[model samples]
Target: MRQGLGTQLRHLIDLLDGAVSAAYEEAGIDYRPRYTPVMRALEGGEPRTVSQIAEAAGITQPAATQTVTLMMKQGLLEASPGVRDARQKIVRLSAQGEALLPQLRLCWQATRAAADSLDRDMPYPLSDALAEAIAALQTQSFGARIRAARATTKSKKETS
Candidate 1:
């Protein structure tokens, strides 16, 4: 039977998550799935507030707060009072977290190498295409549309 597009997309996400988790495990790092997306967003070298990280990670503010708290407790992140907003806390990777970047990169490289080994013919091109797809999906319009659609569907279901 042919899978629906949603099912295929979900499966692809599951595969990627599993691969990434395994890579992190092999590298002897504790992989917090919820925090990975936020950390990835911080790769641009900018310190972000909890709300900003929540938006980037597609999670709720409370979820982001909890995740940040956990990471801070684990020495993976440092939080300080925001310069502009006294009520908000700015978060950034701690020295220990920064020190782990090289190891994280190595894990990512191993994961990429494994993926490339699976498809020897056009690995680089396939990787490039995936990167392009991710970049395209990162647009604000794409995310806003997705959120709106979900909200509409939920409201309709509730009324029914």
Candidate 2:
């Protein structure tokens, strides 16, 4: 049987992330591609809450929170209470993270160039395809389509 779309998508993501991770390792950077968004968000040296970081990073709040926690443990981020709201925690890059900004910037530029090259070689660019797919899904969700298919099958079986 052909590989399912979800599985194929996940495999593609893994392949891309793995390649980037290998590049970081080869360059002597102790960073994961997953942390790139969070690092970029904090590169401006502004303290932001988890929600703000999540929005800026285009990731979920839970993912951002988890990343922040991991970065804190790795000495790449510092978390403190928000001045306006004591209960709210704000996060910013630590000195160690700031020190790696130059290297990260180079990596970011390289990654962007690589992606542009890949897009040029493809029939349809990956970013455009993904955006269109997301728009279609928003118009009619996968779950709804599956339910409709099930209903049609059930009706046909009953008629037969």
Candidate 3:
């Protein structure tokens, strides 16, 4: 049997992320591809709350929290309590993180160029396909689609 869609998507992501991670390693940078979203979110040098980080990074709060914690452990970021909401954590890049920007910026530019080349070679632009998929999912979630499929399968089985 052919591999499922989820598996295929995961394999694609692993291939891309692995290559990006290897490039960072080749550059002697101790950074992960997963860190890119968070780093970009904080690149403006504005201290933002975890919720703000999540929104800016286009990730969930829990994901943002997890990434922030990892970055902190790497000394790439620092966090302090929010001024108005003492419970909310405000995060910013540490000096160590700032130092990495020059190199990261170069890597990012190269990566973008590479992606553009890839999109040009493909039948459809990968970035456009991803955007359309995300928009469709927002309109009707994957779970809803799965449920509808299941209902159709169940009804067919009943007749059979």
Candidate 4:
């Protein structure tokens, strides 16, 4: 059977992330591609809540929270309670994360160039397809589609 869309999407991400991770490993940098967004969000020493980071990084809240937690464990990030909202925690890049920026920036540039090269060779660029898919999903989410399919299945079963 053909692979599902989610499986294929994950495979693509794994392939890209693995290549980037391997490059970082060769350069003696302990970094993951997932760290890039969080690092970019915390650039310039700005303190932001997890939600703010999610918005800045264009990722979901849970993803930002998990990445922030992992980064903290790796000593790449620090968190403190917000001044205005004690319940809210603000996250900032650690000194170590800042120190790694120059190397990371170089890798980021190389990665972008690599991605562009990959896109150029493809008839339908992955980046463009992903962006368009996201825009379409924003209009009609996958969750809605899944629920609709489920309802159809249930209705058919009920009539039988």
Candidate lDDT values, in order: 0.80, 0.92, 0.95, 0.94
Model 4 Cα lDDT, one tens digit per residue, 1-160: 9999999989998999999999999989988889899999999788999999999999999999999999999999989999998899889999999999999999999999999999999999989999999999999999998999999999999999
| Model 4 regions more than 4 Å off | 152-160
Query: Lowest summed lDDT over 10 consecutive residues: which window, candidate 2?
Result: 39-48
Assess every candidate by TM-score: 0.60, 0.88, 0.95, 0.92
| Candidate 2 local Cα displacement, residue 53, angstroms | 0.8
Candidate 1, residues 72-110: lDDT per residue as tens digits? Answer: 998988888989888889899888878877887787677
- Candidate 1 vs 3: which has more lDDT: 3
Model 3 RMSD, rounded to 1 decimal = 1.1
Clashes found in each candidate (C-alpha, N, C closer than 3 A): 0, 0, 0, 0
Tens-place lDDT digits, model 2, residues 1-160: 9999999999999999998999899889999898999998889888899999999998889999899988899999998898989898889998999999999899989999999898999999998998899899889999999999999999999999
Best by TM-score: 3
Report model 4's TM-score to 2 decimal places.
Answer: 0.92
The local distance difference test score of model 1 is 0.80
- The lDDT-based order of candidates, best leading, equals 3, 4, 2, 1
* Local error of candidate 3 at residue 119 (angstroms): 0.6
Query: RMSD, each candidate, Å?
Result: 6.4, 1.9, 1.1, 1.7
Candidate 3: residue 75 Cα off by (Å) = 0.5
